[model samples]
Target: MDHIIEAIASALNISVKQIKNTLGLLEEGNTVPFIARYRKEVTGGLDEEQIRVIQENYAYQVNLEKRKEDVLRLIEQQGKLTDEIKADVMKAEKLSQVEDIYRPYQQKRKTRATDAIAKGLKPLAEWILTLPRTADIEAEAKKYINDKVETMEDALQGAKDIIAEMASDDAQVRSRIRNSMEKYGHLVTKAKKKHTDEKKVYKMYYEYSERVSSLANHRIMAIDRGEKEKVLNVSIDFDEEYIINWTINKFTKKRTSPVNYLIDEAVKDGLKRLAFPSVEREIRNELSEKAHEASIEVFSMNLERLLLQPPMKNKMVLGFDPAFRTGCKLAVIDHTGKMIDVSVIYPHQPNAKVKESQRIMLDLLKKYPIDIIAIGNGTASRESEAFVAKLIKDYNLNVSYTIVSEAGASVYSASKLAREEFPDLHVEQRSAISIARRIQDPLSELIKIDPQSIGVGQYQHDLPQARLKERLDFVVSKAVNRVGVNVNMASAELLKNISGLNASCAKNIVAYREEHGEIHNRKELKKVPKIGAKAFEQAAGFLRIEDGDEMLDRTSIHPESYDLAKKILKELDIKEEEMGSASAADKVKEASVKKLCETLEADSYTVKDILDSIAAPLRDYRDQYAQPMLRSDVLELSDLHIGQQLEGVVRNVVDFGAFVDIGLHEDGLVHISKMSKQRVSHPSELVAVGDIVKVWVYNIDEEKQKVQLSFLQP
Candidate 1:
């Protein structure tokens, strides 16, 4: 445990005390969000990300230690364990390193070396290593002749095989070669001879070669996908001769030895036949793992940003899911996201009921007072947008429209949760509702769908599913807890994401609410099934009741600190009803945190948190982000010209650039090179998914309906 603590502290550059305390809390079954929010003093004020890193590092260290112990036990059972081997095992930081150390002693299948040993040629193989200066190696090999060895040549070949296998098993040799390959190797990919790529999706990779160390993670994922699809063949290209010669020199003791040629042959054979393939696999796996981690991090960050996009509060939105054959599903939702009306409009080809569609839309708009139309960016989206723009212009209606990414709307519509929410509605109708609701409250609606289906990631399907799911789940939980769920209005999906709550518990809470009535206070949560004392302790701070019995329940102040809160209120001469009022804020501003801590016998973190919560009870963290960009006008591909400046919301950020929805059918691309005059390591550093930025048209591919945008003026 001490070793794990020290290792995590050293790796993360955190204090040993912080790591130890955080680990203790985690071991006590405290969720990362709970500890980060409520136990700030115990963790030295570490944020959610930092606490999660400590948890991940601690788990990794524990797993590595267990592996080391297992490896040591296995080696000891074989009576091959030495002080040096034990030391090496103990010092190994990664599982791969430990495996490499244990590879030589691990039981093997029928191999050339094992066959030679079974045939009683082990002594000859050992003798050859001495590199006898004047000894005749062929004569020495004859001494080991047996039923398994027919001739002197056979004996010598067996001995050479054993020596080669031994050389391949040498951990030091494998490590050196692996390191050299990683530093100097190139990943070379080529088009498969028989494969046809009509789309040219992987054209750039047909004859591509890049240094392994310098390759971008997106490129690696792309190449991997291409190879998986059989469009490309990939291999690692390294200086094999240099490695072979280095291995030979490391093993050769005397240049003048008569058996030096045999040792040289064995070393070459061993490296080419055994070591190269094994090391190449290790290198590729390592590179793939790194690429997956980088991609997952990018995906997780993008997902978090998308989830936290500011809601279009208090707006009556019309969801427009556009399609040709199915017409377009339109759902009008009220300010609170309840579906008020549902209709279909065919404003495009085939039916092309332009007049009738406009009448239906006008009637709904007039009836519901729709403020904005959330157009789904799917088939016929631009056509639908044009229709909406023309209707608004023709009728002079007081409404606007914006394109929304409908990446996962279909998936969410068909989900069991969606069915439960809208059992009588069709899938498309449910999708329309989801679209409108997502625009109104993205965090609430988006949480209902799987994060991967949100389509904010790159090569999400190609990455390890379990790892991706784990990361995305954590990101969702972090975002949900950061925003604080409203106990009364939150769906089971949102409630499940709250700290210390699971699907079953969230469902139970909802059931309890349905069976009885609205939970008026935090104490009422105890009456809900599956919510125990520990669960309540971890979740209470993040669960808010907007108009509950206890005033502190309306704020983020934990119930455990209610007494202290009241004492502080009394000390400051503030009434319980004054929370979130201007007078309460003013008084909190004038109070000294240090003096309050001393007077109240409380920690500074607790006092400051309570005071801040009191000043602005139930603050929506999402309010800090920019609201979704609304547009009354629409643009066509033909309307775009170079150097035209336009404001667009960044739709998706990837490794190469950001896609900006410039009110066109196709989102414009702002490549990394054009993102800034200064170097940008990643697109996220410059812009996120929801940022509305001003960009100019650098170029336009009208044929492709693609617009190239740049941050700088052309």
Candidate 2:
């Protein structure tokens, strides 16, 4: 346990005490969000990400230790465990290292070496290893010739096979070779001779070569996808002769020995046939694992930002899901995300009833207090935007429009939850409602869909699905917890993402709310089925009751800290009802945190948090982010020109750059090189999803409808 804690501490550059305490909290069934938010003092104020890293590292360390024990016990049972072998196994930091050390002792399938050993060639193989200067190799091989080994050549070959397998099984040699490949190998990809890549999606990788150490994570995933799709043939390129010669030098001890040739041949054969393939596989697997991790991280960050986009509060939004033949679907949703009206308009081709569509839209605009239009960036979106722009200009309607990524609207519309929510509505109508709700409350709406379907990162489909899901779930949970949920208003989907609530618990909370009416305070949550002591402890702080019986419940103050909070409020001579008032804020601001900690006998972290919560009981972390871009006009691909300046919202950030929506059907691409004047490792360093950025159109490809943008004006 000490060793695991020390290793995690060293790896994360955190104190051993902090790692130990954090691991203890995690082992006690506490969630990362719970530990980060409620137990800051115990964790030394470690953030959610830090605590998650410690938890992951502790799991890895525990698994590694268990694997080492299993390997040690297995070797001991075989009566082959030695002090040095045990030491090597015990000291291995990675599971792969321990597995490599135990490879020779593992029960393998039928192989040339095992076959040779069964034919009395083990003695000959061992004798050959001595490198005797004056030995008759044929005569020695003749002794091993029997029914199984018919000829002297057969015996010699068997001996060589045994020696080859032995050399290949050397842990140090395998490790050295793996390290060398990782450091010096090049990943080479070529277009397959026969493939159906008419779009040339992998054109850049058709004849690509990159150093394994320097390849970007995005490119790795792209190449992997291309290879899987049979568009590219990928392999590692390395100096094979150098590696073979190195292995030969390691095994060869005498220059004048008669059996040196045999040893050389055997070492080469071992590397080429056994060790090289296995090491290549390991290197590729390691690279893929790292690439998946990086891609998942990018996906998670983008998803978090997209989920945390500030709500377009108090605005009645019209969700416009545009299509050509099927007509554009429209649904008017009130500020509370309740669908109040639904309509359809054929604004584009085949059924180009422009006048009728205009009449329908204008009537809806007049009937409802629709302040803005949330147009889905799907088929016929550009035409729909143009129509809306014309209506606002021609009739002079007091309305603006913005493009909402309808990436997952269809999926959500077809979901079981969506079906239950709007069983009478068609799929498109439900999609329209989802689109409007996404603008009003992105966190709540997005949690209903799979994170991978949100479409904010590169190559999400190619990523490891399970790992990607885990990471995305964590991101959603963190975002949901950061922005506290109103239990009375939250859906089961949103509640499920709260700190300690699972799907079943969240459903029960909603059921309880439905049956017994709105929960008036934090204490009422315990009455809900499945929300026991631990669940309440983990979840209560993040579940807000804005107009609850208890004012502290409206804030993020945990139930356990209410007494202290009340005492502090009394000390400041502020009433509990004045928690979010100007007078309360002023008083809390005037109170010294150091004096309060001393007086109340509490930790400074909790005191500061309580004071801040008092200043604004219903503080939203999402309010700090820029709202979604609302535009009164639309830009066309044909209207774009070089050097034109525009304001755009960053829709997605990737390894290469950020895609900014500049009021066009196709989002503009701001390449990494054009992100800034200074050197940037990744585009995320300069911009993130949801950021409203000013960019210049450096180049425009009208043929492909691609706009190349730059941060600096040309």
Cα-based lDDT for every prediction: 0.90, 0.91
TM-score against native, each model? 0.97, 0.98
List runs of model 2 lying over 4 Å from the truth: none
RMSD of each: 1.5, 1.5
lDDT of 2 by residue, 1-714 (tens): 898888888888989999889888988999999999989999999999999888888888999999999999999999999999999998898999999999999998999999998888999989988878799988888888778999999999999999999889999889878887789889999999999899989999999999999998888888889988999998888888887887777777535689989999999999999998899888888888898888788889999999999988899999999999999999999989999999999988898999999999999999998988999988888888999999999998898898888889999999999999999999999999988888999988989999888898787877889989888989999999999899999999999989888999999998998899999999999999999999999999999998889989889999999999998999999998888899999999899999999998999999999999989998899999999988888788888788999999998898888999998878899999998888999888888899999999989887887899999978
lDDT, candidate 2, equals 0.91
What's the lDDT for residue 231 in model 2? 97
Q: Compose the digit string of candidate 1's lDDT tens values, residues 589-624.
A: 999999999988899999999999888886789888
Least lDDT summed over 10 consecutive residues: which range in candidate 2?
A: 247-256
Candidate 1 residue-wise lDDT at 114: 91
lDDT of 2 at 564: 96
